[model samples]
Target: MNPSHPATASRHTATKTILFVVLAVALLVSVLVSAGTGQLGIPPQEVLGSLLHRVGIDWLPLPTHPTGDQTLWAIRFPRVAMAALVGAGLAVAGLIMQAIFGNPLAEPGVIGISSGAAVGAGLAIVFGLTVFGEWTTAVFAFVAGLAATLIVYAMSRAEGKTEVVTLVLTGIAVNAIAGAAIALLTFLGDTQSREQIVFWQLGSLAGSRWSQVLIVAPVIAIGLIVAYAVARKLDLLSLGERNARHLGVNVEALRIGMIFIVALLTGAAVAFAGIIAFVGLVIPHLMRMILGPAHLPLVTASALGGALLLTLADLGARTIVPMADMPIGMLTALVGGPFFFWLLRRTRKRAGGWG
Candidate 1:
């Protein structure tokens, strides 16, 4: 089977197109279902109609239940939107990190951004820092996340060169330090603050609002665009640093740009949604398995896949236990932990040993 053959290329393109369409539809369905499920239980058709009505399409009749419109618009829709944005942002960030580091296992959290955000959130909780009013914790988390990424980048540089191994090691050290800081805050805080800190760590979309959706949507949109623009370079970088450079890719610039984009996307996501894990780590790998290593399709597929995974997780979170809003992060961890172990085992098997 010659990959360069016209029929082979055509088949690959057709497969990718079909997969993309399927994923896009799945994401749409997930969003509709997630928006409809809860204690209130609006039907999926009404949910879609409400969405259309909100956007000025008045053809679909509204739900007769008075609060249906309110619940769908003010609460459920925003929550679902946040899930989609955060999921897409994290997935793209993970894909970028994995490509830059040349490691299938790399994720957005590999650089300690999420840990840094958690530490900042801890500080806000413990000290009662509401300088930004309602947004104080989120602001702190976003700033801290960027700060951690910059520190890791600085530490990885030597004589105008950045090594992937050095970067990853620096991230490990930073994450440990951030974790210690969070622990210290936890130890010093009062009971109420302690509980707040725990909830932030666990991650949830419970209080999602349209305002948050507006803020995060643009950032994720911009990050995805930037990521897609550099997708080809990322694909080349995976071949090896020297090989990428030989092919005229500016490895350092590309690395730095990707690092910034990853930080922006991950920071915004964590700021709003807290520390949802596994979306970043799992979605990109799953998409790559289905879509192969092409970054263009990989990035798109990851966004849709992440959105689908989180939407469904949120649905389960709300419904799995009656009258309980389960932490969305816990659900993802439950699914992703087993998947991670399987991935590790598979990688080892392919390499024939740990080395």
Candidate 2:
């Protein structure tokens, strides 16, 4: 039950505010640091100055370095923006999945969408298809991801309802199939195609452009807006399916809408950034653990946490090896694997294991 006492209500509100402020500040700091820490090494002051200058708040001077403005506008800004958008989109997508499924373990990556998108991307690379010009891979990923989600949703439904265990199992099977498809594509490809496929599967933001960011942004924004609009319904959902229905929520409609939203968000993220793992899974779960089960604040907190994480990770990916780029999926997995184990232990201990 929600805390209705004035003191308890006030406390919850205060905590939510503090969390929002902290995460927002952290995300801002991470973005600035990432912008400044690249090869040309513009200082944070210069990064801020450049941004302010661009926006017509030109009190501060631009970067002193000759190529600073060019690099920031041409390269760093777009990549940083993409990372933030992808991170927030994936995190919110995971939140919706976990909410609808009532399963902490649910995420786009774990539930086969990411792998399905990978299959599409592999096919595009191996066959050298460019039906949509620069958008071929992204379009293919989105379509395949939507198809995979539909397949999982259709196959998992039994007695007009999707059981938690059944949905997860179906997802695993689908992921396995997608994995094999990727492998076959890899085998068919020559050296260049194989290398492209491998790097794409690994995930990176090395060459992000403003055009790609513009394409991804609107899709993610639509998903987030829809998710936020249904936050209260999701809170009812967390109470249980029967309870949600009793409270006048159209549980079926909500589930279907959120599933599509998840596919949309996942497609946008993976289309340009490739299959980044666990931003969706870890961020939502962590925020829920910290902020209680309130969906309104949880959604925003998770978005900020995810944005901060990916922004920093992108920075690390660039600087960790001096000049070589690192795969984002590997770094996120390194962090998420340990957290997932801990989450399992905590959940089991708290609930006496899953029902």
Candidate 3:
């Protein structure tokens, strides 16, 4: 139950505000730390100097030597930024999913959106299609994501109502179908295309560049803004759609709009990062546990928390093995999958309704 006393609510709000501030600092620190820890071992000071210089902070001293400066600029910087953006996008998408479904466990992967995106990307690779020119991957991903969500919505809605149980079931079914399609594409692909499909499925940031960062970062920002604007409606809908309607919220339209936003953000993230797992599932819950359940604070906290989680995870992926690069997505799953299992075990007795 929500705390009703004004003093209690204010206290909770204060705590959330502090969390937001701390998370922001942590994200900055993580990015800087990640920038220094890559191959060639750029010194922290040089990383900072190089980054500031590149960003037009002319007052900052330039690095004395070029080796660490090049490492920071050409390699580590792009990877860290990509990880952070992908993390923030997935986290925002997860928050929206949980809000719309009123279920804390609802995430893109659980509901098949990620799998659908992978299938789309996989097919694009297999067929050598690039219809959107330079942005073809992102475009195809958005289409596949939208299609998957629509299929879930149609299957779950009947008599002008959505059944949460049916939605979960339908998502599982769709995810399985999409997985089969991905497998088929992989089998039919030639050796080169097959390697591309494999890497995309595993999810790596090996070849991250500034251009890919630019392509995805805008979509993430726009989607989060849309989600934030409807934050109150999401809170209302959580109380139940009938109550939301009574309170002057347009439940159907809001739900549809939120779903589309989720698709757009999730699609963009997957398109660029290639099926990173559990980011959406883990980050929002951590944020909510720190902040209260209020949508505004929850969403805000989740965005930062997600960015931090992904950025840190990427750092580990790079640093954990000296000679080899690990898939950032795999790192997330390695960490998030165990947490997910524990969450399910902890909540099994309650069996809360799906959001």
Candidate 3 has which clashing residue pairs, if any?
101-355, 102-355, 103-355
Highest lDDT scorer: 2
| Residue 97, model 1: Cα distance from true site in angstroms | 0.4
The order of the candidates by lDDT, greatest first, is 2, 1, 3
Query: Relative to the true structure, how large is the alpha-carbon lDDT of every model?
Result: 0.85, 0.88, 0.83
lDDT of 2 at 304: 91
Q: What would the C-alpha RMSD of candidate 3 be, to one decimal place?
A: 2.7
Clashing pairs in 1: none
True-vs-predicted CA distance for residue 16, candidate 1, Å: 1.3
Candidate 3 matches the true fold with a TM-score of 0.92
Q: Stretches of candidate 1 above 4 Å error?
A: 1-4, 130-136, 150-174
TM-score of each: 0.90, 0.94, 0.92
Give lDDT: candidate 3, residue 107. Answer: 83
- Per-model RMSD to reference: 2.8, 2.2, 2.7
